[model samples]
Target: MTKTRALRLSGVALLIVGASMVVGPPASADIPFNVAVERDLGLSPRQAEARFAQQDHASAIESRLRDTLGAAFGGAHFDPSTGKLVVGVTDPAMTAVVRAAGAEATEARYSQRELDGIKSMLDETDAPAGVTGWYVDVYRNRVVVEVNRAAATRETSAYLDRLRALGPAVRVAEVTSSPRALYNVRGGDAWTTLAWRCSVGFSATGSGGSRHFVTAGHCTQGAGPAYGYNDEQMGSLGGSTFSLFGDYGKVDVTSAAWTLAGTVNRYGGGDIAVKGSTEAPIGASVCRSGSTTGWHCGTIKAKNRTVIYINGGAVGGLTQTDACAEPGDSGGSFITGTGQAQGMTSGGSGDCTDGGETYFQPVNEALTAYGLRIVTS
Candidate 1:
C-alpha cells in the first residue's frame, strides 16, 4: 500500500489565475451576488461580474477553436488578471485565427493530441511509490511529474529512471502530500453509512432514466445499501468507478420524501442555480460547495489532470484548483458564477483554514462516462 502521508508540496506554487484574489469568511447572510464575489475573490462586485462574463466569452472562443483547429488545438486557459483567454496551437496559421478570436495565441511545441498520447503511454506504466501525480500543464506547455521522498531511496532509482525515460516533454519535481479522497467527514448533501460520510456531487438521470445523484466513486465503491444522513435509505450505489481515468459514482435516489433538484447548497448563502454543465476554462474563477467548506472560490489551475490518489487509487481527467477543502468536501459541488456545473471535489492536500490544493472530477466527463444527463434548470 502507498504511504498515506499528508502532502507537503513546495514544488509549484498555486498558479494565481485571477490576481487580487484571497479567501474570506463565508457569508453569514444572503449577501448580494457581487458581495459574494467580493468575499471569495476580493474583486469589486463590478469586477466580479465582469470577470464572470469574460469567462463565458472565453469559453465560446475555445469552442470555436476546438471545432476549427481539431488536432492542432493544444488547449486553452483564461487569464483572470487581464480577462483574456490564452490559447495554445501547434500550427502558426492557427495563431492568427486564435488572436482574431480575441485570445492571446502562443505557438505550442506539441499538439494536444501529442500530449494526450504521451500521458496515455505513462498511464500504461505502473507508477512507483515515489510518483505522486502527473498531468499535462497546457499553460506551461509541458507535462508535470510529481514525486515524493520515497523516490529518493536507492530502491526506487530504477523506477525513477524509467519514468524519466518516458519523454523530455515532462519535468519531474519532488513534492509531498499523497492525496486521498476526503471521506468520513460530516456535511453537504450529507450521506452516511456505518463507515463513511460524503457529499452529493450533483443530481442526474442515467441512461436508464432512473433518478440518481452523482458523487465520488471512492465514496460509493465497495459499498451498497447507502443511506443518507437523514437515515432514509437512499438506495444502493450503482455504476461506481474509481482509480484510473476518472472517479465518479451514481446513487439511485429511491426515497419518496427526498427530492432531487438541480440546485446546490451554498452554506449560509442561498442555493446556486444550475444553469448548465458547461466546463469552465483553465484559469477561470470557480467556486466549490461542500459540507466542510460551505463555499470557496479559486481559479482553475489546469484541466485533464491525472492524480494518483492514495485513497481512491488513480484517476485522470480531473481539474486542479487552489481552493481549500477538508475532509467531507469530497464529491461536493464546483460551479461557476454563472451557475455552470464544473465538477465535484476529489481528494486534495489541504484544509480550508490553513489552505491547500484540490482537484475535481469534471462533471461533463462523468456525465459522458455514464451516459447520465445532468439535472439542469
Candidate 2:
C-alpha cells in the first residue's frame, strides 16, 4: 500500500480506537440529541451538544448556491470533516471565490478511475521538493496538494500544470495561495501547532527583550525549547499541552524577535486587520492563515471541542471549522469574519485542495492561560 494510504489508514485506525474509548454509551436518562452528534463525529460531548443547540442554516445556503451557480458548479457536498461545503465547479474563478468563502471548490478534470490510478502512483513515491504531502479525497473528487514550505506561487502553479500534462484525463482546477510570512520562514523552523496550523502570528515577552508569539497548545510540545523560523535562537518550548489534555501551559516567548503586525494577512491579496481577540458566534464566519495552507475561510463548526493529539497528548475547548490545514500550518490564527481573533490552528486529517476540518485553541483561553495581551493597532 502507498505511504499516503497507509498514513490515512493508520489515522483511521487510531480514530476508531480513540473513538471507542472516548465515546461512551449514552446515558440512560434523556440525553440531548446533540450529544449523539458529538459522539458520532469524534467530538467531545460538549462540542456536539453546542452544535446541536445552534440552528444550522447551511442547508439553505447550499440550496441557494445550487440555484444561483447551477451548471457553473457541479455537485456539492458538506464535508463533516471540515464542516464546510465542497462545491464542484468548472470555472477557476468561481472556485477561487469558494476558497474565499472559507469553503473549498475544485474544478473537475479527470474521471475518478484515472485520478485514482494517478493518486496511487503519487502516493507511492516520496513527494517532490516543495511538496509536503498529497491526499486523494473521494468526497471532493480531487487529489489535494499539500505544498512544501519553500514552495513559490509560480512553482505551485507549475506543479499543478505538470499534473495536467500527465494526461488529458488530468487537469488543474484551483490553487490556494500560500501564506506570505510562512513562506518567508525557512524550512524546519520550529513552531507551535496553532489550531492545527490554521493561522500563525508572532509575539514578544519577558523583561529581557524576549520575543515570541502565543499559539495553540496543540501546536507544540508542553516540554520544549522551541526553535525559530530559521532554526535559530527561538524560545524554549517553555510550556505546552493540549488544553483538553488537562494541561494548561503558557506558550513561551522565545528570544528570537518576530515581526508583530496589526494585520492578519490572508495571503490571497486581501487581509483583515487585527482589531481585538473577540470570539465570534457559533454560526459566524471565520478565516485562517498558516504556513502550509494559506488563507481559507469557513464558518464556526463547533466550539469547546476536546481533541486528542498524537504528539502532545490532548487539548480541550478547541473551535472546530471547515477550513483546511497541513502539518506545518499548525499554531496559526483563526479570525472571525469581522477580523476578531478567535483561536489558533490545532490539527486535522485533510488538505486545502479538497478541504478538511481544523480545530483551534480559543484566543481567550490562550490569553487567560498565558496572561498575555493581543497587540492591536
Candidate 3:
C-alpha cells in the first residue's frame, strides 16, 4: 500500500507558583516543554492510523471471547476482513460450553489422516523431475509441490503422473522454483529496523549506494534517515507500516554493503544450498530466521492476504504461514525447501514456545518496489 508522510509532535506547558507578597509582581512561570518528536520515522500517518484501528478490532474480539467463553475457550483469533472469530476449544465438550457462553465456536481440528496421506505421497514419489518439496496446507485444504526451472517437458509429464497416483483427493499444484541462499551481515550492511530485534533491506536515495536487507518498520520511523549496522550513515525509509496484514518497513538503498551468498540455514541440523530464485507454492513448507527467534518452520497458509493492522492501516498482499514469530522477528527472511527466498517476517500471534501463525511480505514484491534483485548462486 502507498503511504504518505506525516509528523506528530506533543508539547506541554507547566506553571510555577511561589510564596510571594501581594505587593510583589507575580513572577512569570517557566514554561517547560518536552517533545517526543519522530522525524521521517518511515510510515505515513495514515498507515500508522490503520495499524491502530486493526489492533482495536482484534482486541475487542479477543476481549469478548474471553469474557463470554471464559475458561472453556482455549483461545480465539479474529479475521479482520470477515470479522469472524476462530475460537479454539480444548475438547468437544467445550464446543457446547462456548455456545452456552454466547460466543460462536467452530471445531478446530488438524487432520492427521490427511497429513499422513500427503506425507506418504511425497515419500513415495520421485517428486516429478525438478520438484523439491511437497506441502499439505490444512487450512487451505490443498497440496502444493515446488518444482524447479519452470517444469521441463519430462518434469511436467512426470508431475502429472505422480499426481494421478497420489489420488484426486489430493488436488496438486506446481510452483516453478529455485533454492534460497544465505548471507552474513557485514559490518556496514544497510537495513530497516523492524524491531530492536529484527531489520531488513533498504535503499538510500543518495550517491553512497544502497543495500538490501529485511526489518520491521515499527522498529524505526517510516521515513528514515537510517544508519548502517555499524552506525555508519546509510539511507532513509522508502515505505513502512505495521499491521496484522504483516508489518514490515523498507529502506531505500543508499550504499552497497550487502553481498549475497549461496546458502540458507534450515536450523533443523542441516542447510539448503542455493541454486536459483524460485517461489514456493501456497502449501509449501517454509522456514525463517530473526534476531529474536533463531529459526522455525511451518507450512504456507495462504497468499495475497490483506491484513489489517492494530493501528488502523491495512497492508495488502501478505503471505500467511503457520510459522511462529515474535516482536523481534519482524522483517526476517522466509525460505522454502529448495532454498528460495519467499518472504520476510511481519508479525504473528504466538511465540516459539507455544507456536502461532505468522505473516510475511513476499520478497519479490520488495525487490520490485525498490528496483532491486535477489542475488542467487
Candidate 4:
C-alpha cells in the first residue's frame, strides 16, 4: 500500500504527537442541530428543520415506490427548492400514481435497472488511471463517468472514446483532481492503529455479543491492535475490505475500558445520537464528523458511486456527498440531520477550505457484510 498522507496539525501544533501521546482531547458533548447546516447549506435553523422533515417523509415512501413501480422506478430525490420529493419513472403510466402517493413524478430516459447495468459494466471493466470515478446521476437520468483531464494520456483518450460508444446514457466529465484515501492520523475522536490514526465510524455488535467498531478498510488493513487517541487499547482489527468490493472494516473491541456508544462526535457540536441506519436519498442534507475538520455539512449528491483512489484501488457501492474532509479524517462518521447513520469517510478530492466532494462506504452495507448491527441510542 502507498504511504498514507500525514496530518499537518495546524492549530494543535503545540500538542505532543506520538503513539502514546494524547494528540488532542476527545470530542464529546451534545448540542442542537449542527450549525454547519446553516454555514454549508445557507439555510436558517427552521429552514433546515423543514428540509429534514421533508427528507424523512421521502425516505419513508421510497421503499413503497420502488416495490410498486418496479422496473418503472427510475430513482428518487428530495427537491429542496419545492420542498417535495421527486420520483423519476421510465413509464409515463406511473406519473399519476406517484403524484397520488404525494410525490412529483418526472419522465426518465432509463430505469434504475438500466443505469445499474451500465455502472456494473464499468465496474467489471478495468478503468484507466485517468478515470477518477463514475455513478448514476438520477436527476440527469444518465451515468456520469469522471476523468482527470490533466492525467489523460493517449490510452485514456482511447478509453473515453470507447466509453462514449456505449451510448448517450454515458456522460463523461473532467475533474481537476483525483481522489485519494484520507488515511493517516487524527479525526472526530481519533482512534489509532499502531502509529497512525483514523476516526471511528460507528459502534456495532457481533453475533456472539462481541463489541466492535466500524471504520475504513484502508485504515484497518494489515493493522495491529487498535487504540484510542489517548493510547488506550481498544480492540483488534477483525475483517477489512478495500478493493472493488468496498472500503469498510470491523475492529473487535476486546478491552473493557472502552465502552461503546451509539453517538458520533460532532466536535464542538457535541455528540450526535445515532438512532438508525436509514439511507438518505439524494439531495438530502447530511453532515460529517472528523477529527481533522470537526463538523461540516453538505447534501447527498448521489448513491452507489464507485471511486478509484490515486493509490487505493476502486471501491464500489459508495455514496457521494458534497461534504468536505481532510487527511486523517478517514473512517469518520457521516450522519443525517435526523440522526440517521449514513456511512464513513472513504476519500475525496478537496478539503474543507475550498470545499469538494467526498465519498463514503454506506454503513448499512458494512453492517450487513459483517453480520453486525449498529449500536443505536
lDDT of 2 at 150: 46
lDDT (CA) per prediction: 0.74, 0.49, 0.46, 0.82
Flag regions of model 2 displaced more than 4 Å. Answer: 1-211, 222-224, 243-251, 254-259, 268-271, 309-314
lDDT string, candidate 1, 170-202, tens digits: 778777677667774121466643345567888
Candidate 1 ranges beyond 4 A from true positions: 1-36, 150-152, 185-188, 207-209
What's the TM-score of each model vs. the native? 0.86, 0.45, 0.44, 0.91
lDDT of 3 by residue, 114-179 (tens): 543565545554444444344444343345554444634676666666676755445545443322
Q: Candidate 2, 107: how far from true, in Å?
A: 41
Per-candidate clash tally: 8, 41, 57, 4
Sliding window of 10 residues with minimal summed lDDT for model 2: 17-26
* lDDT of model number 1: 0.74
Model 2 agreement with the true structure over 18-133: per-residue lDDT tens digits: 11111111121132323322322445646543432221333344556556565564544555446556666766667666665555676764334444556556544433334433
Which residue pairs in candidate 1 collide? 6-177, 7-176, 7-177, 8-176, 8-177, 188-291, 243-314, 245-316
Angstrom error of the Cα, residue 143, model 2: value is 34
RMSD of each: 8.1, 19.7, 21.8, 4.9
